[model samples]
Target: MSDLTPDRTADPTGSAGVESKGGDRAQYGMCAGLAGLGVLLLVDAARLAPVQSSNDALGPKPVPIVLGVLLLVVALFYAIDIWRGGVGAAEEGEDVDLSAGSDFKTVGLLVVVFGVGAALIAPLGWVIAGSLLFWGCAFALGNRHHIRGLAIGVAISLITFYAFAIGLGVNLPAGILDGIL
Candidate 1:
């Protein structure tokens, strides 16, 4: 029982009858950053051309405007929650051990993979480029089934391309598969 006791009495960070937890200043920084992003989104939405009164109220502009407003509201609420002395919940349930230090190698690999995909997009087009991005990200994140990942990624990208291009009336560059796609 003596071994389980905490020597809080002698700790300078705490005082008698008072409990102290180290401040999560990072929360405040994150809140501010989110608030800034909300503002930027709102500004960008404002720059979008207004729909003619004849057109339906629901358009590209309204969705982004609503999202920006919601982001601002959420950021405000989070800041208030933090100001009221809330502590963040400990992260849990990830496959990786949280006790292990940061994995910079995996992070760098993911960044490089994403960069390569983005660079390839212009020449390779949506289906192939997006497939590479998806498969590369999965591989970087520890999925080792390269063939399975590539197949799944290519299928997803093709579905997404057709869905957006045919259903939504959006034009995606088809690149080498141009006429065939």
Candidate 2:
């Protein structure tokens, strides 16, 4: 308030008359620029003819536009955060989690289930794919009670099938069992 001023001479960057937050600003600026680029790419993709096809009412433009706007919003948030000196302090401790274990059985089972689902989907349609994904994920998550896991998996799969196929009116592959043959 009096004659006291900020000790710019003691700044870490050693720039007595320069802004000391340049590193933080540069880091966030780079991230924001990259995010903006990603958003622009999606916007450009939405402008492509393939995305504007008459195959569907909304076509592919809707999703890309939504995603592009979302990315741009996030980029703006990052830029504002950097401007507010909200760059988090660097951590000095080890944060690694080395206790994780490999589950080869679950991994192998998931691959087999996906393969079977893919082989059957065109005939079985969304019902099979939804069931396979739910079951594979449940088993992978270590659901040891097979009956309970199966019940939950089937319920989720049927619900998803109804949502995607009936509610959303999205056509799923109905493989060898096309037309309920």
Candidate 3:
């Protein structure tokens, strides 16, 4: 629409364009891919050695096997629906901003924030690094309440870190808090 804006007339999935073959194929392909993943999971689970002292008749393989069958069934149903001219419903989430063009600056900032968080995680720990990541993203997204944003970020990150570490037994890097937390 502007002199500086690249002519997006050829961008098949751009705001200027309509229903694209690439997008349609990708949607169906992803459904097939999900089904493939489920099959792979089930196959791999089947290859696992059975528990010697198993009291439960239904072992680990049953869950993955059931998941695989469900995925396959869903994929088939979705394919049939698509073939019958059925279209997926649009997302009604608050994040929808169809009118706005791509905000490259915000995207770039977020990328940098995430990259920095990854680098810092091993040294600073999940709590600290994740907090910074959250705070950086809030600022990048135009949230001006710096203190409130950082506070929320720190709280959420710390909560998630402990949840994964203590509740789920996942070992997130503790770094400086290694001995303490």
The numbered model that scores best in TM-score is 3
User: What global local distance difference test value does model 3 have?
Assistant: 0.78
For residues 1-181, write the lDDT of model 2, one tens digit per residue. 2645445445443334434344355657666776877678786866768645576766666766777777777887777666655544433448776466776887898788778777766656666666666676677768777778777776876677557778988766655445662
Q: List the residue pairs that clash in candidate 3.
A: none
Report every candidate's CA lDDT.
0.81, 0.66, 0.78
75 in model 3: Cα distance from truth in Å?
1.9
CA RMSD of all predictions: 6.6, 9.2, 7.3
The best candidate in terms of lDDT = 1
RMSD of 1: 6.6
Candidate 3 residue-wise lDDT, 1-181, digit = tens? 4456435546433433224323345458867897898789779888977866667666677788888888888888877655544555443358867678899999999999989999999999988898899999999999999999999998998899889988988989988878877
TM-score of each: 0.61, 0.60, 0.67
Per-residue error for 71 in candidate 3, Å, reads 0.6
Model 1 regions lying over 4 Å from their true place = 1-49, 53-57, 71-101
User: lDDT order of candidates, best first?
Assistant: 1, 3, 2
The TM-score of candidate 2 is: 0.60
What's the distance in Å from true for residue 97, model 3?
6.6
